[model samples]
Target: MRKSPLWIASFLLLLLVQTSGLWAQSAKKASYRNNNEVRTVQGCEYEVLKGLAEITEVEKTRSKSESALGYDEYSVKFKFTPMEKGQQLMADFGENSFDFFLRSGYDRLPVGPKYLKHYYVHKGQKFAMEFLQTDDKTCREQYTYKSMGIPNDLFEAQDSIKAYKIQIAAEKLYKKEKEVNEAKGIAMAEDAATQASGNRPPETAPEEQPKEEEGPKEEEPLDEEDPKEEEPEVDLNLPSEEELRKKVEAELREKEGLKKSPDEMDLDALRAQIEKEERAKAKAEAAKQAELDQKNAIKREKQAAKERKKLEEQRRKEIKAKEEELRDELAEKLAAEKAALEARKAAIREQVTNEIRRESCVYDEKISGTIKVISVEEGPTEVESLFGYKEYVVTLKFKPDNYADLPRKERKLWDKTFTFKLDPKGKSANPGATYVRIHKLFKGNKYNGFAQRLSSGVCNDIMVYSPDLPIDASQVRK
Candidate 1:
């Protein structure tokens, strides 16, 4: 059996923790000394601090004295021959405390049959030690086992009972299938014989006999002497009974090649032959049925593929037609919308041209605005028309740069304003410029003409549209 080193180490670790302290030491040649009993096995041995292990042979249970527990009665019976003193000794029997037991001096022994599994101590054998180390001066030597090998106190033996139990269980399980198969074979053979006997044709009905007529006379007493002469040799050439029997046997042997007669065959052989023939026939039928099934499967798959392809083609055609219809509809709708939009834009352009021509030019027309208008305010409704256009004037209010710096008295004086007129709509000042229209001047009185902007790339901020308008105080109507 195979074993891992980790398994042995784990076993040793558990053993050390449970058994408490047992001072174990190792040497190439040594003996186990336990009080009065001193046992030597190979070179290394166990020096017991307590009564932990025993070296003895296994025997049948003996009658125990009263008051004593009969524990040894249930122990395993072992067969062993003790080795000569110090001749590569190995323990054949040991009932460990828990699986395998060890002490500080000698190796741990396994319970039952195989104790000291994979020998704990033998002269010059390499092995390992566990738990703690011995004092050997150097730091490495103190922590580890002997360099060439493990000392007797360090080495541990394994327990093989688990492996043995598993092997036995496996053996039992292995034989179970064969037993089942044999039983199944017998049952199958019996069934074949029963069915064979049942399938034979039933016995046919016996032929019917005709009744004799009652016209014949009774036997005469004078015919006894003439009996031999009357019936002159009528020869019948039919075969004898023995010949018929021989003929049947010859036919059976020659025609069917059967060495044994039908009645002579034993029940078991007859049943076995019947089962074998039935099995052969069943196998043949299964093979034939499989072939037919394969053909049908292939036929169905091909038909399904053909139908799938046809359906896919039909769907593709429908999608293509729908796409064409949608494309044409979209194009026609877009064309009609474009035509209607262009016609509407043309009508609006014509109406705007007519309005500009009919209204003509109007001068001195103003829109409301904000400025420093402190002087006066006038409206076209009160002043009446001047030159066929409304005249409106406004006063501008003065605002200081920084009101916070001025005294209250001086602030009122400085808060004065001027008056000016803003002509929002104006006609050309030069009547010769026929292109000038009322709408050409913007809110700042800047003319919306190409010549005005082309001369200087700036729109003038003039409120009065007249070309001769003045800003000098002398030109004002003071």
Candidate 2:
């Protein structure tokens, strides 16, 4: 029993399909097993673990398709060892020794090299590591500072903490300063009250002298009859007690009246009146000044308006003059153009009249001759015919049979060779033909059934007839 080639090929394809399906199932089971193992170690609860760790190694894992997934399926794995002795982390993932992985599309982790350089530069110092585990059993690794316990670089965290402390200290200092100022104000107010009280006059009355002893001591006796006993000693220079008492009463009244006497009150009233008068005078002066300023302003405004009007009038005149000048120039230009046009029309009329006269003459005249020479020539390449057709120059020299009977001007033309342009495809003279008849010869005439002149000073449409052909005598006779 021999196997056919087709059967072998089909068998191989079936085997391949079976093997691929088994392989896919095995891969899926392996991935699920790995996920289960990871989940067992890292519980399915949102948590973050932080520790100081040294980066031992970095690795790139196999890349998966990203078409179905929005983000890159490639991952970068990091392996690190805890700095503290006897410290163990559940983040250690399987035999690969990777603590966590970061989803990245780059061949090399973008931030890994820079972070490693910083670590080595700081004398192989350990970095603060953070492992984040979400409820979905996904794990991510990031660098952090232990003090902040947040996912931020060490330097950035330090700066932020320092700025926050500074701000807090500034606020505290401001509050303290405000409290101290308030205390100072209270102390100043208390001191001011104390000083005011100490400076006030005492309100208590003077104490009376003790009564004089009733028994007098032994006197030295009576030298001057005791001038003190005769009458109360009186000093004429000093005011009497009664007078002093009245003066004191008057001073008390003045003090009770806020220290102003009647005369001083009158002086104050006089000063107030003077101030009022001065104020009224100043007000009047101000009013006069304001009125003057208003008048001046009005005058200036009127002057400005007048100037504006004058300028407007002058501008209008100038515009009018310019308009008139332009109109005159336009009229002159139109006149010149009209004169040129008229002259051109007159020239065209004269040319048409001359052409008609020549045509009439040619209609009545007749000439026949034997062709002495006939030749064809290529026309000028640069100059095309008016009808946009290809043309050739044909030269004909003829000896007319009636040369002696023709007029002097006609005879002169008959002696000369006639050269003209003609469309080879249209009605034209042929070079191989012999006898030719010409009914007209003119300088400036269009092609009819006779000779016609072209703008190039050549003749066209000169009718040719062989000698055997019958002549129409009525058409050719004078």
Candidate 3:
């Protein structure tokens, strides 16, 4: 039995189709997963099937940054059976060739998540819904793709689907039109009422009836009905507006009060009793105001006390800081004084040691010098000039008033203005080469000296003598 390839291929395809049908029939129930366990991707809806199986409505989602590749669509379900008894849902269409006609519905879905996030079951197929994003401006493009959880090639004939959908829509619209026409007929009665009130026929008034002629007839009496009967004085018991309002208000208040005891009722006594409601209301308001004021006063007093305490604490801190600073300053001053005193004592000790050594170490020479007082002046320039005026002076040391401190007596001598003439040999002899030292004394007993060769004869009051040592005149020449 040689079979053509086409025939063999067709047989295998038919077998596959029959096997799928069998599988579908066997697994004819909707399946779904637990909602809490699965996380649906954003902008995505699940298609649940077999009562518990997970299904995705669509994998494609539109993004603001990028346009969709083709067209994203939402699916409408179709069933071979009724929704409930004879009622049929719009989404349900006849399924003849497939378990579900995914492609037979509208090309694009609706625009709300609320409507799309649900599961629906049709004849042989379970459906999960999704809505496509739509705008009045965007044109919809038709597309076909694989459905989640369903292994079958689904094709949607665009024109056929559109035509059937139009037919279904026309049916819906015709029904709506019939309802509208019925409503219009009912609404015309309002126009008739308006015409009667205006004493004129409406613009859309119905055609009038023809008048009927009659033979000679007996005259009916005018006002045959009794006037008294027409104007019967029936008791309506309808209260006036003011009285009704008061009665209603009182009833409402009574109900609200829930006063059930008969002993609580006393109409005559209640009427006699003066109403203190306004007074009570006023008293309540006053009491509230008083309570509020008392609270505010307490709060203000507490705040004031806190502020006072803070200020006092701050003042105490400031005073304590100031005292500490003063103490520190006094301690620093005392320390400085002690340092100065120690320094002065060391200088004195050094001076006394040098003096003792000078006296002990006697050389085999004796020398004497004198200076005659000439003139005096009192400043740095005058002191400087003294250095230049001396002649043939061996050596002389002069301290200026503002220079350094000297031995107490020398300091006093330098403070006063004076002049001196010097004799290097004796008190009245001619000096050899002359040299002079000028010094400035400072407030801190600090001295600075400047020495130079004297020009000639200016040390009039100066005297110089060496008892334990002698200087070689030639060697000492300036």
Candidate 4:
């Protein structure tokens, strides 16, 4: 058959598009297969941790490493006995168990020494772990483990466990791809060596015999059909990406404390207003109390001043009364002294008058004579008296005026001297009237007085009654 050029060109273009589409579909299928392999490994790890395990020991060690720069690297290791029920499941797994560890989102866990000590405290307790599955079936689950009655803080770490699991899976995938490439390179090198040594019989014979015996294997048909039969079913009930984003946004709002109703916000504002009013009321009450205290202090000061004035007035009155009492006592003492002095002077005068009258009666005769001489004598005898009075002896010589007509005893006194004792302080005689008066009789003056004679010829009482006659002043000798 003859074909048109336009039809042939259309057929070629269609074949190119279908071939490109098939290549894209094959690449996508391979990517999904790799992701499924990683998820299956992670799910098996989660299943193992879900069972309870008794923690036998926990140890922490520190070591210096070049990777840690200048700081020490800290690591924690745990030993646990898996429960009997989980042992059968662990044995059934063909793959090796994962070495589980906590890591931070921002950096490696146990960045400081305190976190190392935190794991050391939970040594011999049984713990149950759970891996909370996410909405995305392909993503690793979150890790949460705790012992009975233990706080969640003991198991807390930074970042999310899912992120660490994802990183572990990526490292494993890289290692697996590297191993596969290395194996393919080794096979290619072996084939090239066989072709180059075609002339060497012994090396070529051993290799060619194995290839011949293993040719056209019966398992080839089963290998081709397995992928189609074992493909995983997709779940249509899972949430979409947009729904996940909304859910995450809602949780963030709740955590940041922004999810509040209008009524709740108003209630918070009312509470703040009430608190402010109460504080202002308390301040006003405090000010009022302070003012009342100031007024009370002023009143107390005035009362104290009144009390002090009263005390001062009472003190002055007491002082005045004491002075008056002292003055009255002094006046009474002076008056008593004056009355006693006057009484003593009157007694002395009466005593002198009585002594003179007694002497005058004893000497009945009077004599008139011219005094020739007069003398006074003081001796020890004058001072021998109770009143300490002084006595004097008065000696007189006189001429009798009527010598022939006088009696014989009186006639003898004319040309004779007479002596008399006199008390000048009135202890025995009237000194004022007799002794003192006799001292006025001058020499050679005429005197008329009574004289009494004693038995010893001494005159006892001699009175010069008056001067004989008023002589010329120039004629009298004082």
TM-score of 1: 0.22
Tens-place lDDT per residue, model 1, 1-478, is 8535544554555457335423232242233322322322322332212111222333334333311222112132221222233321223223321112222332322222222333443222322222112222222122111112222332222233344334433444445545656888999999998998875788899988988878888877664475456666867987899999988888988888887766887989789999999999999999999998999999999999999999999989988998899889988988877775665456445534543442343322332222332332234431222222333343334334455677999567445543333221222111111111332311233221110111221112223223333222222221
Q: Provide the lDDT at 331 for model 3.
A: 91
Model 2 lDDT tens row, 1-478: 7645544555555456545543443322112221322222211222345455444444433222311221222222344444443444444344424432222221112223333345332222345664433333232221211222112243322323344334434445556556766898999999998898876777999899999778867979666675567566877798889999989988898878656556667787778999999999999999999999999999999999999999999999999999999999999998988886777577556545544443432222434565433555544232222223334445655556666788999777656666542221132222211212252222232221232223221223243333332233222111
Looking at model 1, which ten-residue stretch has the lowest summed lDDT?
A: 448-457
* Model 4, span 200-226: residue lDDT tens: 655454444445455675655444565
Off by over 4 Å in 4: 1-53, 57-100, 103-113, 122-177, 200-478
On lDDT, the candidate that comes out on top is 4
lDDT of 3 by residue, 1-478 (tens): 7645544555555446545543443322222333311112221222222221222233234432332212333333332222222322123222311122344332332212222333332223453322121111112221122344443322322324454444444445556556766887788988878777865545786889998888898889786666566565988997899999988878987989955456778867665553566677789999999999999999999999999999999999999999999999999999988886777677557645544443333222222222222223232232122222333322234444344545777566544432222332223222223222221111122223221222334323333233221322332322
Alpha-carbon error at 249 in model 1, in Å?
Answer: 11
- Using Cα atoms with residue i matched to residue i, what is each candidate's TM-score against the true structure? 0.22, 0.22, 0.22, 0.22
Candidates 2 and 3 compared by lDDT, better number = 2
lDDT per model vs. reference: 0.40, 0.46, 0.41, 0.47
Error of 1 at 375 (Å): 37
